[model samples]
Target: MKKHLLLLSAAAAALLAEEATLAPVSVVATGVEESVVEQPEAIAIKEKPEIELDQVVFQKDLFNSLPGVRIEQTGSVFGHMTAIRMPINTGPYYLFMQDGIPVQSSGFFNHNGLAYTTFGTAESVEVLKGAGTALYGSDAVAAVIDVHSTPAPSEKRTFLFKGTGGMYGYGSGLLEASGPAGEEGGYFANVHYLHSDGWRDHTQADRLEANGRYDLAIGDANALKIILNASKTEAQQADSFNDYANITDRSKAASDDPNYFKALEYVDVKRKFDYARLSLEWSNFSFENLDIVTTPYLRYNRNRYIATWQPNLPANDNELTTLGLLQRNTYQADWGRVIFGFDTEYTRSSLTYDQKFDIQTSGWSAAYYQAGTIYDYDVDYFAIAPYAHLEWNMSDKVVFSAGLRYDYNKFDYTNNLEDDSYYYALTSKGQKAIYYRPGDRTDSFNHVSPKASLSFMPDATTNLYIRYANGFRIPQASRLYSMKAGYETVTLDPETSDTYEIGLKKFFARHTFVDLAAYYMNIDDTITRYKNDNGDYYYANGGSSIHEGVEVGAGYAFNPSWRFKIAYAYGYHRYDNDPKYGDNEMAQAPNHTGNIRLFWTPWQFPGFELMAEYIYVGSWWFDDDHEAGKYKGYQLGNLKASYRYDDHLKLFAKIDNVTDNEYAVMARYAYGKTDYTPGDPALAYLGVEYRW
Candidate 1:
């Protein structure tokens, strides 16, 4: 891998060797008469700096400006922080796009939790708060994070590279290139590799990824673009929980406990993911006072998971595979935009359980017994969804947007078992088993989700907006149909939620910006998982939840060399309908969080910059009982410095967890109590980049 990376880097440098040169020009005044008439001229024209919406931090910066956005450090690739959550068992599924084309796996559930792929190649990360079913597809209940790659520069050729390394055995490298391939075409490619030996026990991982894209300008207003992305990751599981007494007592007994560290139990996992997309876009710029665009796209993704466990019954081993395909079309005109799309998926899973038992002979000899069992199955799912979005400007200051979507899904299951009679008997007793028969059992659902938003711009410096949206998520195959006895599926209703938000934004002095938003969410059919009497886990929709929050963010620039930014958010979430769990706070969600950052450039140092940042995540509950009190809040600090050696070369360094504070962002139920797992303490890195 190292050799291949070096070769690609050399090739990129050679391609960008050609430099552009411009010639000076002089202007001459022609024989034209100019008339000057001076009067009172009392109207004072306010001198204002040009404001581009695209350059605003809310639109471009995901970590600094976006509300409800958190960047946590998981012991995954690079040892650097990932834009993920606190739950170690739940994976953060981020959306990847090349000019608005979705390039992510459709199996949102049951995917490996340690796969973090995109890095070094993204130009911007858009963190859209709340469920994203209206824009994307299913499994977007939390939020939608989109990573967009930079487009090909207008220059003939460009090359970029970066590298970093730090404590706890952390390292990363990246390479990217883009240039004109021929008269009317261009090509781009990016490759990155990262490895880390985590700050915590039994947390070590590595990852490698590559992305390639090509664009051809067919005509003045038409283009064809294609992209291929592949990523592979292998890591030791970090889901182990520390003993609750150990965290609370902070004594030697706690540290000596076997369950306090992951290394005590031998576990390993691996994952591979790949995605590809092809799109054709056309635009019409010839017509006056009107703009039109149309795009048709096809996308495919594959995900694989492998795991191995030691000292466990049957030496636990499992594998799961999922494949997906989708095609979509979108059109935008002067009045509004319309979108239509369809998707399908196939998945296969295999699990094995093994155990060993010891037997004693009567007053003679001792004997040992060993047994192993394997379960293998495959499931294929076919789904078709047609969706549309429309937006219209009602007046000069008030704009309206609305969208509707409908989905149809079908699932087929096949199993290989030595005892078919036992499988048949088990299915006859479960509600979800009706969907699985001797052959294929198919089921479908129809969903109509609506969204509306209104915006009023009273003046250039002040704006107000209100939005209401309905979102839903369909159950995955693993949740709806299981082959194991304790894994009976539930009769899950569609989970739906209605969100209402009001936002205000103000701009002053062209260098100061502020935004505030408040929202309320009501969930109808909330799906929650719990353990049954037989120690088996199942999902059910029997309650409702209410969530309300407020967010505030501001940025101020003292001058061109110094700037400061701050953001704060407070959220209250509780169960509304369940008499048993009504007033309980939701788990894994923080109640209060805030961040501050300062960026400065010294007047004497021409090409050097420095940044200091602080982030705080408030106390949170891990379960409904509130008896756990809180997981305790934490504060983290980070520092970054960069120096531009030249136009093509730059060097930078980042130091995370500057104070080496030990804290927990998540917890798990273990030994009749919630056990907290601490976050990464401290790490640092240095890197260099060359861009031309």
Candidate 2:
């Protein structure tokens, strides 16, 4: 098995050397544009293709084909997660950006945040693995996903439209155009619409988005780019199932609730998001040897969600508005290049919940009461971060890099309903109302992260690196403010991680590329959620944990007509110290995962292209204790076919889970019950496009 894997990696590394070098310029690693091969760290680039990216209308599967990455999707609908280098799903472990701007406010937790972002207008994507906090600040512990918008085409004018319809009433339409705005300016714009009657009961989706960008050049040293985007999404949530053994009906809801959401089969999410950004960049505009870049941005989001709790559930209205700035300067020197960055953000958020029914006590016994206002709060969050990095090109065979970042964060919270009081039941002393008035408070934290790396090149095609990086995540607002019953606001410490890694990148024969990475991480003060015997929830630090993993990926071109790629990852993630769950495997930490893909273009068939892929995920644990039965491992196969037909027209079709396999993409335990969300069954889509 080991020998076979070696041969596969060698061949896989050989497939896409030229394409990897296509864009040549990227800005993800150090916030500066440079050739990809010049970076000392591990980074992968994914370009949009002429055909559909996946069987579904959404681009959730965009990175699943890559190695060391896993995106656990839910029931072929919305709910999704990004796991790279980290084992956990929902937390401050990952960061998502568009044109280097954050898609959402940091420390905010939303499972399906990707559903609202625009991807149709993107030119390419870059994924960076391991610790990025040395430059990214908070929430860059595991990985970072950056989406770069397409640059305006050189043509005088260009227009394109794409449409698709397929199984389950799936439909999609997109219109895009790019060209010169005038003599010295360029613009790109697009609008997209997608809807689907999901595969299961009470699950459907509708979303619309519009995005535009303008680029202007001012003389020899200054450039400006403006971006605007808006999106509206109405989607139903298909929650996971609790009974893992009895899934007789796959299309039904896992739990039966008598609330308005369940009775009328209403939606779980109704949201509107708008964003605007202006970037001013200067090359040789600072001192004789320095370049400076600055970006100022704004974001707004208004959303309402139906509470999924049992009994008389109410709705929550939330509004978040933010203003931010990112400024960076790089100095060119004979010895090495040095970069300095300063970032700041101001956010105002308000949340109001109405008529939430809770178990309260009128006297000595337990009672159920409908509370008028469970929570009404507003907060102002602020962050000021600064970082510096140095890239030293010692010689043709050796490169050294180091960086350090400091983040200062503060939150000022105020309760709008300070006078509003409520009584709670299930208290340890019988019946006691939790402190309904949290009053006003100010909290702050400071964290510093540092990193260093050394790279050696045996030849131009092979690069090896050893590095150490540190990252940390500040506590989420919800964890700090959402006090229930007897639990009060508990002062929390940030979660910190120290990682040591060694990796290799090789591009041989100019047609093959391969990469392998292994890492060990030690994390302290990992926060976990729990419920006491009285049913109130609290967050506490789970002493320590250990995560270690190995990843391999390769690509090779068999000939002018064929190409192949493969990726695999294996990891052991477990708790190092915790009272009851000591040494238990963490939930949702899949240990073994892999993907294999083959692409073919027949010599006789002029415009025909075909692709086949197989995916596998090995089970880790369902709960902290690890479930009892069933094989946690499963495999799936997907296929894609396309015909270019002509320069102005094309057609494509894709099928996922070709064998109709049954598996679980996400599983966990909640309220003492094990729950799992089954993977998507076989699904297909067909589409056509026209460009001029």
Candidate 3:
């Protein structure tokens, strides 16, 4: 292979680290300039590392060397899930943001959606690939993740604390504070705590999180801000959702009956989340051409579960509440730059599912006591979107853009049942069971999304582009009150997509850098969940799909400390015109995935640093008819280090799965065998931090 590509180009020659110099500026494709944007979609960023490590832990290390990201967890503590070139750990095609709004509360609280995000209270994390409905509308189809926090430091006044302990009895703590909350204002605060006893066996976990912020400087153009956050959790993952093929010790655990709950806090997993936000700003407002931003927000969530196969059923409650309004303005003429926005949201959801009575062993779910509440519901949702964006600059090597967004969604469902029966004894030994009544519904949908792009820099480190976008997704609320009231869940429709992209970026001679993107998507009406002819389970529109992908990334710097990075992604999904998964290849889709990283800092190292990583995942198909003993590839290896002394200490360490590779971070194929979820073996941790 050309001498392995010249020994991988002499091992990615020239690795830099002055915080990996150059290439670090994003405003998420244009929310109106915070500088450095060349946009054409497909952006991924994760900054904050230049020897600042306390050894953060998984959420997949916040995608180190980002590019076609990946995040999956189950070794313990917060089981996150994500995959970017589509499918593995999927859910409404991704879209979870925090500083750019949309943080859960999108069309019926997706299961495991963003798993109570906060990824350690962010401070940079932005990702966007193809199709984003010209500035977010609907579920943003293929990608969007924004989480930014940590800003409220201004020169003086500061304090931080950190703590850590390792080896299956792990512990963590963090506390922070930042200066002035007045007098030209500033403010920040954080609190975090976590506990684990995991590596397997009835895993144990605990968490508490907190956040507070305030900033003000209302003159000289105005400003004001406020934020608050809270979190709580208690976890235990008994061999994950049960059924692990006769269990040969894949971390033991297979539902310990816990004497069938009824107390002890419902005997297992519980979680809660809360958030509040407010902002007001001007900074120009009509005078210097215009600049305005406004925000009003509120969020809340709650979860409970205790019956991973109905072990006597009786705990399954979920709730959500949301409120929002976001407004924007940025207008700077010269026949170009313009942006206008309006987004409003309101959501309320509550669900309950609990039932258990009689029967003796039929197999998984139904064989014991009583626990009422068969099915209950409450849903209320409303959404609004209005947007516009533009960028011209047609010379100097062209640059053109356009965007438009319009979305309206409505739903109001109330089912507090007056009669319900949806029980199925071990899958059809009771001749199936499906019955329901308890109406009152209203649904709505509207969409209009568009976008265009063109860019060709030709100079200043290269650039090239082509793009088109449109996205949509709506129909959830658990696929609409679990259907049964005018089939097709009230005229199913909303699950749309249209994307086309091409990209290139370069920076070569300054210690290397490169990125590439390619995409094609067409999706429509795709909202699956089959089985009809009286086999129960419904929710239609199921058809059409075609997705293509290619993503690449590279980085090199062998200067102020060696560095190297690599990324790859490849996908080719099918199933166009589905009536039952035609052409297959779209369930857990993963044609290829990649990663590589190496960084060091020796050469009179002044603060020490090192990192090593390798990850790859390929081969997938867990259904949608591409079945054949189902596969689900895997690979991983990790190591990290950091040291700092004098400057208020900092020390870190990590070693994970370093060759302990046992695989199976996830897998499937039910009823006739095949199940896995064992991942996590060689582990280690160390930490310290202090600042002033």
Candidate 4:
């Protein structure tokens, strides 16, 4: 690892010596457009050109290139878990959006929520690290990611087609079209399909998605933009392998031991997801010195999957429908600016859990779960947030910003099943109730978050800033109502976090760009799963946790023909004042990670480009207990090349995991054994793109 870092540093130094110019860029994820060198936030962006150059097939492939960001693929198409300035986790810690519109309600956060968006059709993707600004509401604690759709072509009509095939029976096709309508309108539409016979057993998956956008000029100073997206995904979920030998084999579906069987049997275990959304944006309407933007959206999603990781194989079917609106008004003056906004959403959701058949095994883990309906419930969620932001330009060299937001969330939960204990069994101690159902209840919570930042610009191309922000996540309905052993009622507090960060952005000689940031976050009232002395599990509010990290990203455009880029981060995450795991390193949190890439467009060969990338992940503990020891991380190499054959045709090829190193994407200790999810092996892809 040290040698690789040294090599990357040397290459960067070499590239920095050359003279070149990289045009200035702007960031638009903060509800406003501002130059990168002037913004006080830690932001990273991937534009369409870069996405096309890499032929990105998954969201992880694009996000892993950003600093302090790590995404792990879970052996299924579009199944990913994200980590940003915190431990790798799946919950309501991060917010996912499409063109500034939340794709899913925060009350129903899902780990695979990104799949609901049409990533393949994005014109740009932006990520804001640490706690989000006051412009966003709940579930914006660790990070916020927004995907922007491709704009319609105004000059002429164009069509694009792309096809690819790779190892592991992977294949995909895409069709896109954009054109001008009349004189003041345009439209863009696209459809994508992908299929993969996953490397692991029983993990075959397929997805189909479509996106459409239209822009209409309402008048000289106002416009309307409409967006539509839909997708459907189907897969056979994979199970973790408990044995080291089976992990390496890559073919085994479960452990060889007869005592413990994998969740999925020879019979197919189906997992399906369906999503659809419609949103309209009306912007740039000015009244006096104020400009207003309004957006109204509706979305629906449904997911059906088997609980493969749980001891009891309960099949779950969940659905959510959301209607939301966003209104913003910005007032500008000579000395400063004031922005005020309000966000409101109404969601209706339902969930059902069923255990198809009783576990025949005598293992203690599955003894309490019987073959029956575990839970059936319906929930209606309502949330409203109002926020205000003030930016004061103190002087030519300094700027001060402050923001405040108030959020009100309410949930009306109704139990469809009998409000009583469903099953009971005898444990080592005594007879105990295995499952408990609670009666209908209504709960509400209110929270206030305040944020402040100061920016100092010593020169035209350099900025230094310090920012502090507060964020929170409302408890989900299931966590608030679902009951387990020894409990008839459950109450969980909302998770809250405070973050302090210092950052610097610099543009040197218009050729090199650098961004550096260090942040510390303290989270309170963390919701954690607790196990009693009787070995029954339940949800509770744990103490707290601390996460601190430093991230650096730099790009040196030596010339138009040669460019070098790198992103590196080092993070520390640990439990703080927790009874179960005091001061212990968090699970799935790596110490360091880095990505380096070199792009070359040879002058000797016309319309030809080549890219080489190196990726590294540092070691980390397998679990919070640290009983299973550490997992020595791995490194990978990838290469990509493209050639434009003509004005309308192009050919591209890529090889990933070029060294064919075997590794695990995820690992943990459970059931007195270490379980692993194997990563992808060496894969090769070739594709053709046509445009007219």
Among the numbered candidates, top lDDT falls to: 4
Those runs of model 2 whose alpha carbons end farther than 4 Å from true positions after fitting are: 1-25, 50-56, 245-249, 252-287, 309-314, 355-371, 419-437, 509-511, 627-631
lDDT, residue 28, candidate 1: 9
Off by over 4 Å in 4: 1-29, 252-267, 361-369, 424-432, 509-511
Count the clashes in each prediction: 3, 15, 7, 0
**lDDT tens per residue, model 2, 1-692:** 01111111213223333444532345798886665555666676665562254534555566777687887765425556777876647677877787787776775545455554565445677778777836687777777778775554343577889888877778889898877766566777888888888776656777777778776665555666677767676766555665655343454553432333342443343333334444433333535677777888887766665554323345677778888888888888888888998999998988887654443333223345445676788889999999999888889789899999999989898888764355353444555674355777888889999999998977766778898899888887767776654555466899898888899888664336787889888789888766677544467887787888988888899897888878888888888877656887777788888999888889999888899999988876666666543337678999988888899898888998899876777766655446577777788989998989
lDDT of 4 by residue, 1-692 (tens): 01112111223323432321342344443586556677788988776667777888777777888899898876455678888988777778989987788888888888787788788667778888888888887899999988776554434688999999988799999999987776677778899999988766667889898999887765556777789989899987776676666656655353344433444452356678899999898777446667788999999999888776666667889999999999988888888899899999999999998876656444545454457788899999999999998889999899999999999999999999977646554455555577777878899998999999999999877899999999999998777766785766557889999999999988885437899999999999988766677556677889899999899999898887899889999999999988898889998888999999899998999889899999999888888888889988878999988999898999999998899877777787755457777777788999999999
- Once fitted onto the true fold, the runs of candidate 1 whose alpha carbons sit more than 4 angstroms away are 1-65, 71-116, 244-374, 418-440, 459-462, 483-489, 507-511, 533-536
Q: lDDT of each prediction vs. the true structure?
A: 0.51, 0.70, 0.67, 0.80
Ten contiguous residues minimizing lDDT sum, candidate 4: 1-10
Worst 10 residues of 1 by lDDT: 35-44
lDDT per residue as tens, model 3, 341-453: 88888888888876544333333333343346656888889888888888888887788988898889898888887633343333333443333444667888888888988
Q: How many steric clashes does model 2 contain?
A: 15
By TM-score, the better pick of 2 and 3 is 2
Better of 2 and 3 by lDDT: 2
Winner on TM-score between 1 and 3 is 1
lDDT of 1 at 157: 80
